[model samples]
Target chain A: MAKKDDSPDGLKLDRRNFFKTTGLAGLAESIAAPAEAAAQSTPAAVGPGDVPVRLNVNGRQIDLMIEPRVTLLDALRTRANLTGNKKGCDRGACGACTMIVDGRPVYSCSTLAIEVQGKQIRNVDGLATGDRLHPVQQAFCEKDALMCGFCTPGFIMASVALLEKNPNATPEQIKKGLDGNICRCGTFSRIFEAVSSVKGGQRG
Target chain B: MKAFAYINPANEKEAVAALSPQVEQSMPLGGGQDLLARMKDYVTQPERLVNVKTALESTVTPVGGGLRIGAAMKMADVAEHPEILRMYPAISAAAIEVGTPQIRNQATVGGNLNQRPRCWYYRNEEFVCFKKGGDRCFSPQGENQFHAILGAGPSFIVHPSSLAVPMLAYGATFRLAGPKGERLVPAANYFTLPRQSLRMENVLAPDELLTHVILPAPGNVKSGHYEVRYKASHDWPIAFATVLIAMNGSVVKEAKVVMGAVAPVPWRSAEAEQALVGKSITEATAAAAAEAAMKNARPLSQNGYKVDVAKTAVKRAILRAAGIQTA
Candidate 1:
């Protein structure tokens, strides 16, 4: 065990000590008071507040009052209650927030809901018809391409877009096309197998 | 991200009128690929965001013998444009190396060219580096493996655009619209070094918006782009090069060699161009040009590998442009 130095006990100065001391709290409060006063002195211009933002998602009209800072991913998951798209790196690094907008896949997390008002938005939830699963979904289940199913939705959406563009994609194309999405469960081999199993294979 | 005002203008005039020269007061929203990321990280807090994609032109059209590309055109559309694929293959090749399919489909040309540097010290809000108005740069003393090797000064950030390198090689001219009206600037003069202004990367004013890029008609030139990346799919390249050479018979008449991801801006290597002109492009000429490209490089303590990688990029670009396959 290491012996503690007890000369002046300067180690006792911490968050607990700051709260216990009287003049220190006053010092902190006094320091924060000026910042608050400065903020009030110069108020930032604020408009385009929570307004009626409308988006056409999955062929359905959705109207909600949200702030301009709210992204399309938040609008889908929180306001519209469509949580099919996941918010994985809110920046554009990961593909977990991918969704088809105007027949092209885009990172929903990076897109502003206000900007995509009239564009078509499609998520993983819109793939199935009634109870029948999409062919890609069925293939994923058959090939066991998922473990915990966190990255499955994004992969499925990417696969749908890739096949629609190049149905007869070679192994090289498949490797390049789905490189955006990552699978933590190490199911890439199975996912590739599932994507290549679609019938009517031909490049569009 | 802090709450901000949003505006969608009816047309280009309205859009330009809505924007101000102050980046903090208002900013034009392109694809939001870079701006939204910075906002989420609390790096920039603009009070207003104006949607410019709705107002700007978003198509690529034929003009004269060359092509006129709208600044708002998506990277996917630009990469897949038939004429671009045939006439300017280097542009398409550079576009393909930007990001994955999702990013390409959403990111715009103006945004891609004008995106902020990807330096880790600058991207993270905790480090107040020189790029963010701080006094010192963290990369020179700290982790600097990915920093710039050429044209570096107080800041060591590598330019992050994939398209800018090829555009300079192709001799493209940019059209910008602002409160002072429109002006045409050559692509070579668009980018500036940190010595000029440490805050911004290019000549674009906060109130100005890039409208169009006009490429001169392709002459008797062979162009190619080659990028060397740690990851083949999505990672940014360690070094990349674009070469455009005009040949008379089997001898080179003129050449333009520009390297990216190894400098503060896209580096045009006049030394390499001098080595290539008036010589037949062979294994010897390509290797000589490759060596000459790195003659002026001043690599940092940790980024000497970039010099070797960039030399290989120049050699490969020349070989590929000359239709030679190197295993």
Candidate 2:
């Protein structure tokens, strides 16, 4: 038997209390407990004293208080109000929440909000200057690259990031690159045309 | 989805210490591609999330006749890596085959290797399959077209990682960090089948963290991957095969045959490998190996076609790697 630590608060810090206070009381009593308890305890909850998170979004530094579980999509859409990055699947399946993190386009929904505190984050909202749209966005609109337009922002942002990396990306590369973003309305042809047009312009 | 505390440690020591005895309600946050989705779907609910991204100590280096890929390295980074593309083209090909572009960008190599299965029963909150400690495996009779055709007994979920199959074929090893310190496990034994353990996929302890993957240098070995899917785009393959052949002037010296989406784990066909050894890769040999590979398959009624599909894929992949044309 393990010895218990006695405190002035009359709390016995034994395995039972340790398990109880940790929210594993039910699990601890289950068959999985003895095995899990032999291993190290899970991480503790976040306290209030954690440092403030400084998010660099679209080349601008913004400070906010976020819990550890807050995702980048939630931070961008809910806290920072950058709604251009839509949350379609929220599970990294649908690329509707795609954004550029430190020059690499990623699914913001699958990235923790606090992870990219110092890294630069570029969303669909960053593509426009006041009223003028980015070239990729312009081409997308001109070619009617969207039907329902829900997956357009993510596709456009992904295209911009892809074009930035491979200025002369082949159609096959474009196809592979855009494989992450899914448009439910089946506007793949127009989207491919828009991307190809952008590539052609860059070459000329 | 649930409220949780998060901590990002700067070093491995700090990470280990931070993971020390606490409230006992924690889970490590990796790429968050799978973990976050599980959380949102209520598959798992953890009160604390420890972020170990900053504590990555491994580096992608060409060390001692092998390339060490840091576990923290993103799938996109691995897919685009020059050395990786030049040496282990199959690995790069596998990395590119996983999920979609957004997933590849955010999903880490470690997370991909350690990700949970995408079985419909496991994904659905309603069905509590044998994997979830239920009495029966839902995949045995109900909607098992996507289930395994090899090394499956109690559970029939297919191994989800597209990279693991090729890694095993290339003789890769995983560098792991745990409470006892660092250790390495061969890719062949890294993934566990349902017969071995129904509850877990890999032999990772609760505290163990995969640090990197070490791939032996491609020395006179030719490797390739072939995946057959309904859609040509961002969909998991219905069946896939990865072949690594060691050749001496077109004569087979040795061969490693592995198949994905056809097994509870990455299925290694020793018989198929045996059939390839000591013989040149001919159309007849490839076909024979494919047949031998699926000889022990006890596929479900709905998934019976997978046996043929997987065999064809294995044959095609072997021929492609051996530079042989099959009419």
User: Of the candidates shown, which would achieve the greatest lDDT relative to the real structure?
Assistant: 1
CA lDDT, candidate 1, residue B141 = 86
Q: Per-residue CA lDDT of candidate 1, range B5-83, in tens?
A: 8777756787788788885578988888889988777777787987778779999888888899998999988888899
User: Candidate 1, after superposition: displacement of residue B151 in Å?
Assistant: 1.1
User: Each prediction's DockQ?
Assistant: 0.26, 0.27
Tens-place lDDT per residue, model 1, A1-204, is: 113221223222233454455333353333321112112332323344655566788898777555677789877775565788887887878788888888777888889887788789899988988998888889999989999888888898888888878778788888888888888888999999999887543211
In model 1, the clashing pairs are: none
Off by over 4 Å in 1: A1-48, A201-204
Interface RMSD for each of the candidates: 12.0, 10.6
